[model samples]
Target: MATRDTHNLRSVLAVRGFRRLLGVRLSSQLADGLFQAALAGSVLFNPDRQTSAMAIAAGSALLVTPYSLIGPFVGVFLDRWSRRQLVVFTNLLRAALVLPAAALINGGGKGVAFVVVAFAIIGLNRFLLAGLSAAVPHVVEDRRLVTANSLSGTLGSICFSAGLGIAVLLINVLVSAGDSGYAVMALVAPIGYVASALLAWRSFRVDELGPDHVTAPKRAPMHSAIGDVVRGMGDGLAHLASKRGAAYTMAAKAGFRALFGVLTLAMLLLYRNYFVTDDDVHDSITGLAFVVVAGTLGVMVAALVTPPVTRRIGGWRWVAGLIAGIAIALPLTVSSFTQPLLVVAVFCVNIAAQGTKIVVDTSIQHECDDDYRGRVFAVNDTTYNLSYVLGLFAAALTLPADGHSPTAVFIVAAGFALIAGWYAVVAGRWARRVGDDIAQPDPVPTPVG
Candidate 1:
């Protein structure tokens, strides 16, 4: 009863900062969805199937790759400087970049410049996401972290799914009106970007404490740039290795992330085959049934249940079970294509996996110390993105454009999930051992008279 009450109180029904961030997340996602719609169907119009897909991906990667190069340096800066200023700077620049692309679309130019600018805007937006993720924890209290994150994740999923829906719907409307649909699609992102910028500029204070409290800035002596950078990176890596428990967390997260990447590739294939009909949604409303509704509910359960579950049931045992369930579900769904009983099983797996994933990720973040938090977190981000790219490329090669493509992706992703489940099992054991080492009782507190 007390536990239930505690969960209710920590319920995190509202926190102003989180609420603001949530709104921005939704708006940005709506725009992102529009962009996806803008790029999706036309890519295949070019000669080679693989080539066009790559072109579309490459355009987005143009943005992503640059951000990857800059993100670490940016993360370091985020820890070292005024976070608020950084937030405002990133938001304003992104908003400015986004507006012109939309204007170009409005003016009826789907030229190289329009695509190129859109790519750059998407890439830069990542740094803003990084900045926001890094800053959010600082603004919210420590205990409130899980609830805040859980809710945020739920909202993000909803917005992302809805954004895709909105993009499709808007494009349909534009076509009916005989307008260049790119303008309508492109406009969505800029509106969200501008809104996010305004929210940051007018509402939130650039939090100074996190930067102020972070580890001392490491300045290498003037020397050969390459050699110095390599050595500095080595030193930073050593600190990450020192945290035994943290190491387990990082390893598990990386494996899970890799699996996540594989799943993403599978999802694109799934939607292409199952949901789309001549670029129009068919009678099936699974996108609505699966993502917007079920996915959101899963997040809610994750947020509401994970804390107590982890504290009581412990970690690995719970996590391993979740992934294992996914492993079973994905293959069955792919092989049977959600045959009679299999479809229900797949949905159940999705709900369970999402819920536990929330707990596991949140706990990992909590374990991160302030000193190397940026580096560690950045590594997670980099690895996840790279994994996503590789998985996508591989799947695109194997998965066909037809409806059957989703099945192949699912089978491959199931393999990835099995690997993830294995990691969860091993990492859980490691976490327990680490716990034992740290469990040595604190030296008796000096007794007050």
Candidate 2:
């Protein structure tokens, strides 16, 4: 099974366009990691800042919510526009936007100018990600999408972590310089964005990665067109409703992410206030970096584990079982609250998260029409971030400064168990009624040029 999976992966990688698209995703995600690390250092972990659970959670909400609200609306354009062009343009724009943001950090300016620039960069990131996901079907054969998504998403995640590690190292090296150090770290992110843009510009023709069918009104006035696009979100939702498997998988992912968010905040506070037990913010950064590495390694493990397991038992069952496993394991690993044990917990949770995401993404890509794919993915991204932010705030209300709350861990565990059971029951009934064998693979196509 492992040998066959490896062959399938190699086959997917051999496709020229898949390789290029994967490059675009990797470079873009790497920049995401770098920019996020710099933001975390400047906003949350700076020695000058007084950090707490509520403050951190609020900051996270502020950074995520505005873009999330507009994500679905943005999807309308993704369906109308050339995705390759969108990828290239958004990357260049992000690169341009980061400069002033970095300069603001350099001058220790955390005012409106910094916030506005930072929000613009993050908003463009959402568009780039949705465009990338929607473009996957254009690059790979239908039968190979599961493997392609696993490889692309997992590798992208690892590269993002790599960027984080790199930025963190730079910040630590220049810790004496304070805000200027973080500013310098942020400037490094644009290089990745430019590389991604250049690769996309060079690798494919203008129309290669596409919304093959454009359904927007041709001659409508600008305001009227804007209204139609907003209304188009309903069409996307209606289309999603018809694809029960994809809808169920997306719901499961949203539930899992909310719980993941709670745990994430707990982990951060633990490192900052509990594990380090000292004044130096650098210690907390180092500790948190280890946890992030553990999680990234676990995501890689899932890329290997999920394809074969889903092939054996089907994607939905595998997803439910993985979530169940996390429910049972989380309390035990987190109850002790020791750094080593928490690392193990993070590793296990990410395996479940990434494995579920791989299945969810594949199911959506396979089931939905290309016309609505962008909006569906936009909805997907919005739900993903919103659930996470809500979870963060919810946990913040219960968590203390040191992040020690056994009750919180147990409650999260129970929530995971409920999500697993709900998904299993709902999805099982739907599959039976629809007579769809989701486990069945599509026949592999001849290799692409």
Question: What TM-score would every model get versus the actual structure?
Answer: 0.77, 0.96
Runs of candidate 1 with Cα error greater than 4 angstroms are 1-15, 21-27, 39-63, 103-116, 174-179, 214-236, 244-247, 257-263, 270-294, 338-357, 403-414, 436-449
Query: Per-residue lDDT for 115-145 in model 2, tens only?
Result: 7788889889988989999999999987788
Q: In model 2, where do residues sit more than 4 Å from their true spots?
A: 174-177, 214-220, 442-449
Clashing pairs in 2: none
Give all candidate RMSDs, comma-separated.
5.1, 2.8
Highest lDDT against the true fold, candidate: 2
Best-matching candidate per TM-score: 2
Q: How much is the lDDT of residue 376 in candidate 2? A: 95
Local error of candidate 2 at residue 393 (angstroms): 0.5
The true-versus-predicted C-alpha distance at residue 434 of model 2, in Å, is 2.4
